[model samples]
Target: MADFSPPDDNKRTGQRGAEKSGRVADFRYRPPSQSKPQKCGTGSSAKKRGGGKTSIPSPKPQGSAPSHHHRKQAYAALDLGTNNCRLLIARPSGENFTVIDAFSRVVKLGEGLAMSGKLSDDAMDRTLGALKVCAEKLRRRNVHLARSVATEACRRAANGPAFIEHVREETGIVLDIISAEEEARLAVLGCHILLEGGEGPAVIFDIGGGSTELILVEPGGKVPRILDWQSVPWGVVSLTDTVGRCTGSRDERLARYADMRRVVSESFAPFAERIAPRAECEEEIRLLGTSGTVTTLASLHLELPHYDRREVDGLIVRSQAMRDISERLSGMSLEERSQLPCIGNDRADLVVAGCAILDSILDIWPSERLGVADRGIREGILRSLMAADAEGERHRREIRGA
Candidate 1:
């Protein structure tokens, strides 16, 4: 089995100004535009910047349209990650953008990639099905300019390229397999705005399905300057699948959880060394997390009856509280974890590994509080495309003036 079910579409509802939906929201700030963006140096790579388009008609949320111009200029971003497939459609509104329609589904694309070193057939089918839904949503929304991406799972899979072609042929959507560096960058682009006001260096991380990215950034820059990044080969899906089953008493389960943490902690040692000097003057430093593990944990921390993106995003929970939750969760059996509100049966087995990973991260960088963000690669991709669009518009205006 693929480990996840079909997602219930989060329909936009009645709200006057800037309302947020489930697992998606209107961010408080947009990433500052880059004065100069380093190019990938190849023509093929250059063309990937906002290169695809496929738009169709779709439903809209209740409320007055922000602007006719906003509707006329629509952009879309699709992110097929190791565990979840997500889509975001938005239009420029003032300095930022408003999400018009969005979709997210857990496909568990890397369910067994850790040991197998390849995407399983069931996982591929699940992912492709979710992508098809994204295609339809994009079409219905008439998304003109769009960028679709696949992350760690596709990068390491044996038949990743073939699967990309298959997705295109079947869903009329193209998926770009991005590098680890780009993946970390996009994640930062999408989520860095969630960082609380601080001048000290920051650590932003995304705990994914097959890998976890730990990025060190120097704050106070337009887009936080990515000083260094490390992609550890341990995500929730890969970690859980590799950790074996937890079928014993609470002590045994906690021991297994501890083992997972040890493995992740060892992986962080090298990264920790590189940043050891920076840890000296840690005043005003911040730690922000973007991933299912963090968000799910945030929901658990809040004890929300169901997941709420608006409430969770930008939320600050104390480090001790997060640890408490992880500790409490580790003591529970898989069945107990599955009964959790946001976790359910589909995510029950996977959440423990996630908690373990989170524990390891806290061990490395002990911040007072962790910022939660429901946004990531998709949000990052949208910012890139919209920024490119704004630049193109300026260029055209200059040409006309001349």
Candidate 2:
């Protein structure tokens, strides 16, 4: 594994902030772009849109037996969300998957969409650029089967279908606009690997750029029974836009955080009620959090002065440590936060809002320790594809034997 360091600079000039703000503002009211029609589902079209060459270089030859034989073939998954676009290419190794290639960029695909009910041109362009890179990587890896999904932003946007059409036309990547229920299910599937040989009921929460998903499960089952789940619209970006404008004193910011927490708690009330019926009798309830917010917090708790996925992933953080980290972050200005190795200029301002949302979720659930998960939707998609492939292989073998 390679060492990961935070970006060197965190200071954003007022001008830069204004520029980003302007982009956001433009997305809020601008009309969709009128471009040439795209041909859907052709491999050649995808290759052209992604660029002439592949994004990831081919793997080097090994001295002995080919690792490709011992290890299962590579599988790919892409998740395009309201705030970020990400790709993961991996192969199954026994019970878990080893990542062969991965890419992620924050594009804010849903930026200002809440107000306009449509994806802004600037946001669409940024998202498309990220997808192009992902497509190239997939091609380079020679990934035979993969699934790409788009969440909240596309689901909410009035022009989302057009946007999807454009993506197929340009990238040849069909973006499945997943429903909230499906989103929750995929999150649980990705986190299931973490539950192996563990005890008690577990609660999984995934906080994304646009929405938050919560799931409750009990032991004694191969798959965790979904006791209850909820998808809350309040996320880091949305909350920050609401709470960032009310800055005054430290006390005021604290009050604002409290207000944000109240709102999240209220949104989670129905789910809370559904779980409360069984939660009391269940022994040893555990909390698991999957998203950038939790991972960033884990990095800060380690005080590494850099972000290393290996160290942060699957680590456990105590409630007090989480609280301390949140307080430290709240005290720092956006520029100061940008300087932190775990948080860079891209996430400085938005991270505080994420922290607030996580804190609220913690208060509602009140678990002592939280299991941090770097994997989420992409992993879930890969697992589903792999399972289908395995089943197909089994059927073929059975037919041959017969």
- Compare the candidates by TM-score and give the number of the best one: 1
The local distance difference test score of each candidate is 0.72, 0.68
Query: Across residues 1-402, which tens digit of lDDT does each residue of candidate 2 receive?
Result: 122111112221111011101000000111223566753321220001111112212222222222345346778888998889999888766555677899999998877765666788888888888888887787788776778888877877778888888887676677788877677777777765554245666788889877787777655544466655667776776666544522556777666666666666766777677667445656666788889998898888777778876676667768668877887777676667789988898888778777777887776677777777777787777767666555556566568779
Residue 191 in candidate 1 has what lDDT? Answer: 82
Give lDDT tens digits, candidate 1, residues 349-377: 88888888888878777777788877888
Clashes of 2: 0
What overall lDDT, based on C-alpha atoms, would model 2 receive against the true structure? 0.68
RMSD of 2: 13.3
Which candidate achieves the best lDDT against the true structure?
A: 1
Q: How displaced is residue 19 in candidate 1, in Å?
A: 34
